[model samples]
Target: MSWLDQVFPGTSSKRTMIDRSQALPGRTTPVAVPASHVVLGHPLRGEDPESSAGIGRFPGYQAVVLAGGCFWGVEEIFWQVPGVYTTAVGYAGGYTPNPSYEEVCTARTGHTESTLVVFDPGVVDLEGILRVFWESHDPTQEMRQGNDVGTQYRSAVFTVTDADADLVRQSARRFAQVVADAGLGPITTEIAPLAEAGGERSDGKCRDGRFYYAEDYHQQYLAKNPNGYRCHASTGLKYPA
Candidate 1:
C-alpha cells in the first residue's frame, strides 16, 4: 500500500497526495468552523456565491504563505519588502489544529514553520513576491534547509489561487533551469494549494481554519534577537537581468 493508503485508507484514493515530508503520519485533528465558512481548496457542496467572491476585491492587497527554513528570517525578509502590509510568523501546512509551538517543533503536529505575508499588489506583484521568496532561501534542500533538518524547515510555497499555483509551477521550472545552468542540483521545494481548515471560504470575512498564533516573543524573533540564527541563503536568482 502507498503511504497515503497507510494513513488515510479509503480517502487516499480520492484525495491528491502532495510531496509533503513534513506531514506526520495520521489524520489531522478536525477543526470546527461555521457552515457558511469555505475552505480554500475544497469546493463548496452547495451554491454559496458569497463565500468565493473576494478574489480580486482588494485591488491593492493580497495574501500569500511561504515556508522557508526558520520563519524568523522569512518574516524579516518580507517585513523589509516595500509593499508588504503585514507579516506574521506561524505554523502552516500541518496536520494538527491550533498546534502549539513546542508540539510543532517536535514534528508530531505535522506543521511547517511558515510566514504569512500580506502585501499590496499595486506595489509588489505576485511574481515579485515569488522572486523574494525564491531568493530568500535555498529550495534545493529536501526536508531541510542549511543546518535546520526536519520537515518543519523544508521549503514550500502555499498558493491561494489557480493562477498563483500555475505561476509557482512555471517559476519552479524556470528556477530549475537557472540552477542547472549554474551546475546546481534539483529543486525540491514543495508547491501546493493552501489547504483550508474545515473548508472555510475566502470571502474576506472568513476566519482561518485553524490559526494558532505563535508565542508572543516569536512575533519577530530576528528583530528581537539580532544575533539569532538564520538558515536562508541566496540562490542567485535575478529576473530580467
Candidate 2:
C-alpha cells in the first residue's frame, strides 16, 4: 500500500467534532522539528538571546497559537509582521498529545492545523496581531476554511492567559460584528485559553491545550517551497479602526 493510504487509513473528513473518547491515542514523544526557522533564522523552540524585543509575560516574549485554514500561509503571514519573533506551524486546540499531519487530516485527532506566533508586544500589540488574523480568513465557515473541508482547518485563537483570553474574546466579538455588518455569516472562530481550558467540546476534561510542532518539512513550507499551495480565504474586509 502507498504511504498516503497507510497514513490516512481510509479516513474521511467528517466535519464534526469527535468525542474525547474517540480521539486518537497519539504517541508520547513529540514530532522532531528543525532547531531554527527557515525564513527568520531564529530558534523555533525558545527565546532568542539576540532578540532585543521586550521580555513579555511568557519568558522573553508573548505568544499565541492560531488556527485559520492551512498553517503554511498563516505562518508566512505572521513572520513578515514587524514584531513577530518567529513562527511555526503546528497542531493545537485538540485532544491529541502529539499528532501527525496525516492524523489531523483524518479528523480523528480533533486538532486544528495551527501556527505558533511569538511576537514582541512592544512592537505590535495583540490587537494588531488579531487584526491581521481577522482580515486573513472567513472565520464563519465553522469546520472548514474555503476548499479545505475538515476540523483541522477551523479558525481559532489559543491564548495563554485569562487576560489574553478576554482580549481575544473581545476581538472576536468586534470582528463578528464587523463581518456581520459586511453581510457575512456569524463568526465561528473558536477563542479560549491554550493552556488552561480548551475550546468548544473541550468539556474541561481534555488535556491542557498544547501546541504540537509539525514535522520539519511542514515548517516554513512556503519559504522552502516558494511555489507551494497558499490558501487563505480572506474576506477582503479590514478590521474596524
Please provide TM-scores, in order, for all candidate models, with all chains considered together.
0.69, 0.87
Name the top TM-score candidate: 2
lDDT of each: 0.63, 0.80
Best by lDDT: 2
Displacement of the residue 197 alpha carbon in candidate 1, Å: 9.9
lDDT of 1 by residue, 1-241 (tens): 7554455455332233222334444334422322221112221112331242211122346767788999988988888888776666776665565666776666655467887666788899878888888877888766666666666777877766667878888988877887788788598886766644224235322222333345556766777788997777667665432
lDDT of 1 at 27: 30
1-241: candidate 2 lDDT, tens digit per residue:
5443355454244577777888999988888888888888887886441231111233667898889999999999999999998888988777877788999887888789999889998899999999999898888887777777778899999887779989999998888888889899789888877765344443545643677889999999999899999889988888889
What are the root-mean-square deviations of the candidates from the true structure over C-alphas? 10.7, 6.0
Q: Give candidate 1's error at residue 184 in angstroms.
A: 1.4
Q: Over 4 Å off in model 2, which ranges?
A: 1-13, 47-58, 197-208
